[model samples]
Target: MNQLTVFEQREVLGKEFRMYGTPEQPLFLAKDVAEWIEHSNSSVMLSKVDEDEKILMLNNVYNQVSTHGGVRKEQWFLTEDGLYEVLMQSRKPIAKEFKKEVKTILKQIRMTGGYIPVSAEESDEEFLARALVVAQRTLSKKDEIIRMKDKQLEEQAPKVEAFAHFIENEESSVEFKILAANLGIGKNELLSILRNHRVLMTDEYMCYDKTLGKRVKRYGAKHNVPYAKYDRFFEVKQYPTDKINRVKVLVRPKGQEFIRKSLVKHGYIQERAA
Candidate 1:
């Protein structure tokens, strides 16, 4: 048996990439899908086929590919060897060899039915739930990923309520607006922080110094020591004086690993994550 490398194995498997754009014509493992996976993984996808010459090829192929490890790493992949093992043990009949089985699998996939289309004429709660799951599962798992995830949920969750209440009501008092402005932030920013992270929700919101702020004990205890709460927040400070000025120090809240990579590539920033 020929042992295929990772690149080659990916190429072989690329011949069966699933369709994401189409719902009604759902996933028949067509040419485009194959081409995508092949181009992505190249060598590793091809070397996993084994000859059993008995079971159905589609089941064999599905069984062979493992998606456990790579999914967590955001790759969502399976090794060629892993796929081969699945085919070997599958209840479906396998072709005499990997190449023959690959063809059979492709043909079977083409014949299989596609997804049932959902309509946008009316909103579906189930669809929303599924969307939430997808969003959570595929969310970027970086340092500030929680903030981004919360932002997504907060932004999307209000759609269900029709936002009629928040829209119809202009109840944000002048005091709240003054408070937000005092902190160099907006009312919405304060609201998001309070609702999502802080458990302090009240109609009578006000701006005050740390000594007079509600839950001052907890907040002070949490961020008491100098450079204790967030070292980087202070490290990034480029103020001429002791007070850190945010405008002078722009921090790109550590997005994807690639963002830092691109920044480093252009000499705009340096990696400080380590």
Candidate 2:
């Protein structure tokens, strides 16, 4: 005959109790219940009970021998009704709390439709069947995630390759280099172009006028110029100083294709002679 297996474990009053048997016919260790009761009410005096009374209580529950560390120990397991009878005998507040906990566990088991016990000595075929089911479920979820990531990469491949090609070629335009660097395309360039454009567009110049005796905005053609023409439509800032700062025009995404075609048309970026 197959023996009941431990299906769940719960702690009450700092003592752990193992729940055994199928979910439909749940059982708790008699010793664990006794300990819980004793901990709940020190006045119950369970230890003082005679061996005859203990045996009588044991008869109400199932007895099994569990081997631990090469030692066989007899364990008494009780049904819910038997446990309730035992708890009702005790007049402690913890006993009432333990009863409530038992009700919750029973309700959960009922809702879950109870747990089926695997045989202690399961056949290799049975074990493999269970393992395969779990492995299939895990692999199905992983495959779905991998497919989603692959699709994303596929959609982004052209953009990524175009940016990479722009960065790798030394002969590429300074504007492309700056834009690529700003967009985190390559590791060599510093200072993001996008951030600089926002800053330069919002930059305000103030000066103190002697007549006014207060700071006034410096209105000039350059100061009022649109952000798109900061560095001749490159959207990049160029500082006018003795040191030469190469400023390249910024091409928007919609205009990039047109620019490329125009360059080929003008023989700037030459196409292969077919």
Candidate 3:
């Protein structure tokens, strides 16, 4: 048998396990597995096993490999069955989660063909080409995951905005229409007042570049150039109704404060005792 080489390491719940062996048969270090289980649950002890039984198990499955520096190292490795026995014998509750993690690692190793070993029949160029293909596939998988996360964020934006509005207005009972009527102003005028005070934001627009004959689109607030220079090249786009409604000034407590202060200053309502 070839000297065991660590091909993969995975951290599960803060404990680490290393996968070693060739693509045909994968083995895990028994000592590392025991340490991981003990770290996960301090109560379960591997030392309870009889010394003779432990020696017998090690003698049947362990490997002693010679290193290039004239050093011989003895490493105890476990097969799937051996690992199952070790985990099942433990009385810790975390043993179940550890078993599941082990299963996941085994599945991944099988799916990825465990570890790639350089064969005597294959040249260096061929091995490099195979490794390059695996790397490209891994990168593509990562890109797919990122795209999924972005889509999830886009879908949840409106809900998150609505939740924030609920939290801000949780203590206030005033509605938009009721507040406008109380202030003796139209709803649009109330919104305009808040916008003027920087308590509310205006609808966003998309800016384009007609001079370059290219659609270099930019968001209203994110545009780098002055709007006066590109006013003619921009297209007015209303913000999404759901997002607008969620972030409306009348629905926010701070907007109510601004309205109250403005009304008191303009004599719409008599100033109350401070």
Question: Which candidate gets the maximum TM-score versus the true structure?
Answer: 3
- Give the distance in Å from residue 55's predicted Cα in candidate 1 to where it truly belongs: 29
Of 1 and 3, the candidate ranking higher by TM-score = 3
lDDT of each: 0.31, 0.49, 0.51
Per-residue lDDT tens digits of candidate 1, residues 187-211? 4543433322222222233355576
Per-candidate TM equals: 0.19, 0.31, 0.32
What candidate 2 gets wrong by more than 4 Å, as runs, is 39-73, 113-274
Question: Which is superior by lDDT, 2 or 3?
Answer: 3
Show where candidate 3 strays beyond 4 Å: 39-71, 114-274
Give the poorly placed runs of model 1, Cα more than 4 Å off. 1-72, 76-96, 114-274
The candidate scoring highest on lDDT is 3
Q: What is the lDDT of residue 135 in candidate 3?
A: 69
lDDT score of residue 254 within candidate 1:
27
